[model samples]
Target: MDEAAGSPAVSRRIAPQRASLRPWLLLMPLLVFLAAFFLVPLAQVAMMSVTEPEFGFGHYASIATDGFYLRVLADTFATALLVATCCLVLGFPLAYAMAAASPNMAAAMMIVVTMSFWTSFLVRTYAWMVLLGRSGPIAALLDWIGLPHGELLFTRFSSTIAMTHILLPYMVVSLYAVLRKIEPSLLRSAASLGASPTSVLRHVVLPLAAPGVVNGLTLVFVLCLGFYVTPILLGSPREQMVAGVIGQQIEEFLNFGEASALAVVLLASTLIVLGLYHRRFGLDKLWG
Candidate 1:
């Protein structure tokens, strides 16, 4: 009996280690890919940021000392925040509706959202440009409505609208995944306990959905921060974002140092936000 008990305990001890090893084994390929593609590239960029154009911290110093660069950084963060907030506000209702939908309806919605992902992003941006440009259909409609002719294209407003549309699906899908997992009985229980519809939502639904909301917000915010093509196509010079600035430095000025420095700053900012989120809300909760 003693030998049998000891054998069980020994197996228990070995079981967890063996199980852990399996996951690490499964993760080995992903780790190798990340190290090869992401870490190596990132290391190269960091080296270029500090060591190019005669070395030292000149590129970073320019970012700090130049008022125009500082303004662009601020604008980039502002635009990202605005786009995230808009996505949240717009996506929440759609997510709720999707979650409450029947299986067939939800499947249909998923198909539509997935189809959007297959569409070319550049084509979508150009479509927006064609619709919003002066003398385009929207501009013509405004003129016919007795409104003043508006130059909406190539403006910050146009950029924001386009980005919000592009990112809305991400937010919806994130929230939908979490919302679908919630037990319908929980809401029914709240109602049975004399909770009103608004009370049930305010107390039960919102708390349950908090994790998904945070996940979606983080996703949208990070994506918006790194936006390049849409902003370049839709925004004017004054509305240039960090990504646009980085691209110009790399492509037009051939200043890889400054471009990499800007990229590092953007990367650091994103990491800080993610770290704070993980600290405050435990990363495990984000996966539904």
Candidate 2:
């Protein structure tokens, strides 16, 4: 029998000083795990980015000078911004509807959103492939309607639409959380004070939902920055994003050093976004 267990009441009354150490003690294993797996691997990648194929920052220099790499990096950010904007535009109304619905209606909407989200990511991408392909239903419908079905597959438009669909639930849930927390009386009071519905939403609701907007944008943008399969499969070969370029370097050219460097750049960009958010609003508040 352990002494701590034998004298349960005595253990519960342990000195206050030791209680402070308990949290750290409980966290030790997770710290060790992250240090071993995450920190060690990151360090290795950083070392390889500079040291592989002879040292001396050649990969970094090339990235700075090369037009192709610079263009891809720019395109990556542009696409992420587009995707995040589309998500917010489409999600805000749906989330508002969900919040405004009765309990049963809201519950059903949530279930549908959750089911879509839980469906395999690849499955969603492939479904988009089927829908956007030349012989698919969308093109068929266009043709039937006497409209010219110009090329749709392997276009930026297709990729953006698919990515938006895949990420929409994230924005919806973020907005739904914030919207649900808003007091109904506040909106009623605004109306009673002779404010129009649009005015009430613009002044009161939008102000309250700002945190969720920031959170959804940050979440979607960061996720879009790292998007791999969707862009490669759906986007044009001429327009490549950072993740696709990184994969091409590793798989097609076997340029590990350059790929590692690109990966580091992407990681740094993500960290900068997070840092800006933290500076604006504490990280703890973002999740809430």
Candidate 3:
């Protein structure tokens, strides 16, 4: 009886083997659902990429050698990078303001960010369409200022701006989360020690916020890589993104093998970004 009494304490200190099993048990249904609906379909598409055109890798070869496809792929990656940078630049200040604000003010700012984030994707896209249109406020202002008008829409500028706006909230939220964790006393201490605001930001705040910065960049870049609607609706024909090219292949050319190959390439690019992000910052850091 004495030994059994101690056994309960021992068992409490030693985590059970079933502890790991419980999480897997909980995840089992989600894994099964994903396997059925997502993985299986994805596997079918990947299989078709090589199999549909008589078991040759001709589709991939075309993508590798073709100038137009290469250009679109290059543009897609460059645009993603640009948009990610824009989001960071725009969100960092906003996030810092949120972190530095009074509680009520921060809450209000967060509500605004949340609202922007939850706004319908199509609505935002169309709003840009209206804002950049020939009869829109932007064009009207340009005309009033006696500058060139009607050159705003259907350009890379419009598409890039729209994508940056759409993704800015992700960066702001990431930065806000990390910044909020930083004890206010730290900043106050730095200031008390005669550290200038810029110096404090450069030395202390930035280092602490590095993880959030990386996460934000990763999210925005990966999301932008597959972005289609804004580019298609607002970008010029010459500015076709990889996704737009994939759509063109399917809709206009009726080429499934090439489209699947393009899709596989897009997936590979996304995975590569995520892999780099994981290497630089442990994947667990993002979720945790």
Candidate 4:
């Protein structure tokens, strides 16, 4: 009887896994909220993708076969890639400067970089409209320079410039986070070893900053994929992105199933990109 009382089975029975459930119990409210809001809405979207017009995958099939749908998807991806590349090219130098600056200077620069967040993106979009308008500063400058100023507003160039400006901060912040962690001593050491400035940057700086680059590009690309307002307002009417196409389907045509299918495709594409990145570098290292 005494041996049985102290047995492992007895111990397990006494505990009854109650302690193990405490953390889950604490998390139940958050889990329930997510299920009620996010999961339920997403499930509805998925269902509508197949079932709204009738219980069929006709919308997806149409999307697969339609040249318009394919072109929109291709354009969306190309725009996202362009925005990401532009942000990287412009942001890297600014971030490097911030990382190399004195603490006071860096803090000031960071404040400036992050100031865009304080304003509404819609407002910023309108501001771009004003700036790119026919008699705007850019056109005025061109006029002053004796150059022909073609239409800047309602063009791909306007949209690309607006998106790059809007998304530049994300890239800058990501690169700054990584670049700031790099030790000045290490750079000095590399220089002391007879490594040229360019070589040190190419080998040491870039490799260390690669994670930040990937993180920034991923963020900008994914966010740009679903961009609606800026693209619609600033982009060329002839070149419609997937998001714009999805909105038009729902708003103009009242075709929820088609819109839902487009949304699902966009979501799946985003997930695939994230999955590939996770497989290559692991998602946890994104912010590191």
Best-fitting candidate, scored by TM-score: 4
Q: Put down candidate 4 lDDT per residue, 80-173, tens digits, no spaces.
A: 9999999999999999999999999999999999999888999999999999899898888988999986799998899999999999999999
lDDT tens readout by residue for model 2, 1-288: 787676976766686668799999999999999999999999888888999888869999999999999999999999999999999999999999999999899999999988878889899999999999999999999999999867898988999999999988888999999999999999999999999999999999999999999999998999899999999999888889999999999999999899999999999999999899999987776666
TM per model? 0.86, 0.91, 0.90, 0.93
TM-score of 3: 0.90
Residue 167's lDDT within candidate 2 is: 88
lDDT of model number 3: 0.91
**Model 3 residue pairs with clashes:** none
lDDT of 3 by residue, 1-288 (tens): 999899988887676765767999999999999999999999988988998867989999999999999999999999999999999999999999999999999999999987977889999999999999989998998899999655898988999999999899888998998999999999999999999999899989999999899999899999999999889998878988999988998999988889999999999999998898888887776643
Q: Name the lDDT value of residue 236 in candidate 3.
A: 77
Cα lDDT computed for each candidate against the true fold: 0.90, 0.92, 0.91, 0.93
Candidate 2: residue 145 Cα off by (Å): 1.7
| Cand. 1 TM to true fold | 0.86
Find the candidate with the highest lDDT and give its number: 4
Stretches of candidate 3 exceeding 4 Å from the true structure: 1-25
**Candidate 4 at residue 163, lDDT?**
94
Worst 10 residues of 1 by lDDT: 279-288
Model 1 regions more than 4 Å off: 1-32, 189-196
When sorted by lDDT, best at the front, the candidate numbers are 4, 2, 3, 1
